[model samples]
Target: MRVAVVVMETSHHRDTEGRRHIERLAATLNEAGHEVSVFCAQWWGGNASRFEPDEVTYRGVTVEPAETSFCTRLPALLAKYRPDVVHAFPTPSSVLRAANAGAKLARAPLVVEWFGDHEESVSARAIGTANQFVTPSELVQTELWEAGADSDLTTVIPESIDMDLVRDVVPAEEVDVVYAHPLDDSANIESLFLGLAELRQKGWSATVIGDGPERDTYERAAADLRIDDRVDFVGSCDRERRLAIYKGAQVFVQTAWREHFATELLWALACGCIAVVEYQAESSAHELVEHRDRAFRVTTPQEIADSIVASADMDRRTVDESLAEYDHAAVVEQYEALYERLVDEYGLF
Candidate 1:
């Protein structure tokens, strides 16, 4: 299978969760024995039109990350590549429109990876061009529906984690609570801080993992609440360190206001942390806790505080066997199945 992934900006040009997700998917498909080529504005320092770093081949549609120029060149490049499937990112929307033309020219099925980060109006128009749409969560699917996407054409595929590492890594020192997310304006870490502040008289330690523009603001909020001493702001640790902490921690608190899909929360749950998700309209965090044991969904700091206290009575776990379905290989199989189904429908085999 030859897959052509279309994203105007590679992660190297602009690092974002959406870009990272698509790039990771391309690599995973490559490892699964598919011939994957990423079409984007060149991020490498050279005049070469193609760069093969690792197994995936990255074809430069433009010399630089100029949105208009890349969009103009994409259709011709993708038509020339002649992939079995054209997987595209739904951001600028123009790129999706361009990729649609390319998919038609190449006679390939177009699948849009809609991350739900763009404005609803633009996203609706962007999704209209694709044969199928893949969202990381139903929250995004619903958003796209409201944006004018056909429900029949869309599918939800959750992010995957390394369950092997979950089973193998030794736990870090135990703590009562753990919260991890980039401390951006939308982080909502203050909610966790206020929740923790309510239990100041109680004996507990919390670790806040990750860093961003608002890290100091959140740290100061912790100080203002007088819980700074107990809450450690451990900035931006790697996945293994996070998994170790999740394994050691009793509860994982998710208070981010805007998450297309709560990836860190998924990792925490697979590692066996009792999930306490604060409901936010834009976040899909609560979806992860649906009908699941040892998970609480709440909307306030008081409720989060109460849930934290209540989780102590629940049985401790090092790993949840139920989450094995979300392992990396399993999720990749879902992608493969989707690709095969599309190809069969198009009679491209």
Candidate 2:
């Protein structure tokens, strides 16, 4: 089967969960004997408006930039590629419009991966144009249904992690808590700082991974809480380093106000860390560690601190076992089945 994955940017240009998801999907499809191509902007070289076309092979997937602009060049690109199915990531209204036009022009089924919330008006139009919808969690699917999308055409497919990256490292002799979240407003960094302050007496240090606009603000807050010395702001690091941090830490806390899938939470579980996630409206962290023994959902800073203290001596084997269903291989098989079903229904073969 020939598949065209449409996204605004690739991991080559930006490192985002959405781009990684698309790349992994493309790689998995290619490995499964399917022809896969990615249509995106040449964001890596900072040349999105280059007159000449930009093309490259990234992780065994062919990436072709939409040269003129996604809106203007996508239709022609789709016509040339002639894929059996067009898989588009939910980006912006303009891009989704282009993807819809391109899919229509190529006479291929359109599958839109809705990862985040969009304006209701824009979502209605995009959903109307898309043939199928794929969301990472039931919370997102519910949003699509409320936007007038056909429930039958929408499916919940959870985000997956590369289990091979889950290294078996012994926890460091020193007790440390790990919090891996982009220091963004949505991450609720304030709550985490407050929680860490509450646990100051426990003498357990913390390593806060990831970097963002709110880094300074959170750092200031940590100082105000008087836990600055105990918390280390390591900023962003490579995947290997992140896994090592998770493996060495006794607990992982997620204080995000809302998350569509909470990939980091899943990663912590896979790395054998005691996971504690703040319960939010759209959080899927509960899905990963349903049992209270493995993970806890907290609502306040006190609860967060308390959960960490309680989970300090817990075993990580059960939490790791719970993530088998979200392994990359299992996720790839689900996507393959979805693609085959869509292809047969649309008579694309």
Candidate 3:
């Protein structure tokens, strides 16, 4: 099957979970013997020079960059590519609308993936335009349904991890506590700092990963809390380093106030880290580790600290079985099945 993936950006444009998700899907589809093409914008984060306007093969997938004014370019590209199915990410309204028009022009079935927590009212038109809807979490599906999407057409396909990259290299009890998230305001870094401060007195150490605008502020807070030595702020490393941290971490701490889908938390769990997520209405992290023995859902900084301490003795192997459904191969197979069904049903010959 020839598949055309439409998204605003990819990992080439920015290193984000959503873009990485698209890249993984495209790569996996190509590896499965399908011809996959990615239609995306050239300029992401004002770095147009980084990507050429011409088409290029990236990781076994053909990537065709479009103009900033994608509305005009997308339909033509779609018509020329003539893919059997067009999979689009619902974001940046313009891109979604463009993909919708392009899919119609190409006479291909449109599948819109609702990956982020977008307002249903604002996204209703895009959701309605697509032939099928795909979401990584039930929370997103619920939002789409409430926004007037056909519940029968919407499917929940969780984001998956490459199991080959995730393995228990170190026992959980022998590893240190680790927290990884952008040091932005939404991350609620203060809570983690407070919790770590308390844990430091008990002779515990933590490694804080990721970088953002608020890094200095968080660093100062760590200094003020007198736990600066106990905390290591190793900002923004590559994937290999990040995975190594997860593999060796005893407890993976998530202090974010909200998350549509906590990809980092899922990675840590798959790497055999005891997960602890701060309870939030919008967070889907809890869904991944429903078993209390594998995770702890807490409400306060104190509780987070306590949970981390308790995780020192819990067996990390308990969470290993829960991650099987999220394996990369399994998720890719589900997507392939969905594509085949949609293509046959729509008769996109």
lDDT of each: 0.90, 0.75, 0.75
Q: Please give, for residues 175-251, the per-residue lDDT of candidate 3 as tens digits.
A: 46888888788778788788877776587878888999999998999999998887888998777677787776788
Query: By TM-score, who's the top model here?
Result: 1
For each candidate, give its TM-score against the true structure. Answer: 0.95, 0.84, 0.84
Candidate with maximal lDDT:
1
Q: What's the true lDDT of residue 91 in model 2?
A: 66
Residue 154, candidate 1: alpha-carbon lDDT: 95
Relative to the unseen true structure, what is the C-alpha lDDT of residue 88 in candidate 2, on a scale of 0 to 100? 86
TM-score of 3: 0.84
Predicted candidate 2 versus true structure: per-residue lDDT over 1-349, tens digit per residue:
8888887666666666666777777777776677777777655444343322223232111234443355787777787788889998776666777888888778788998877544324556766888898988887788878878899999988887777667444434344578877878787877777888888777778888989999998888889899999889999987777877787777888878777788888887887788788777767667666664667878888898888889876764423655777887888788878877887887854
Deviating ranges (above 4 Å) for candidate 3: 8-16, 43-69, 92-94, 117-123, 168-174, 316-322
What is candidate 1's lDDT per residue for 155-252, written digit by digit as tens?
99988888999999899999999999998999999899899999998999999999999988888898899999999988899989999999999999
Error of 2 at 305 (Å): 1.9
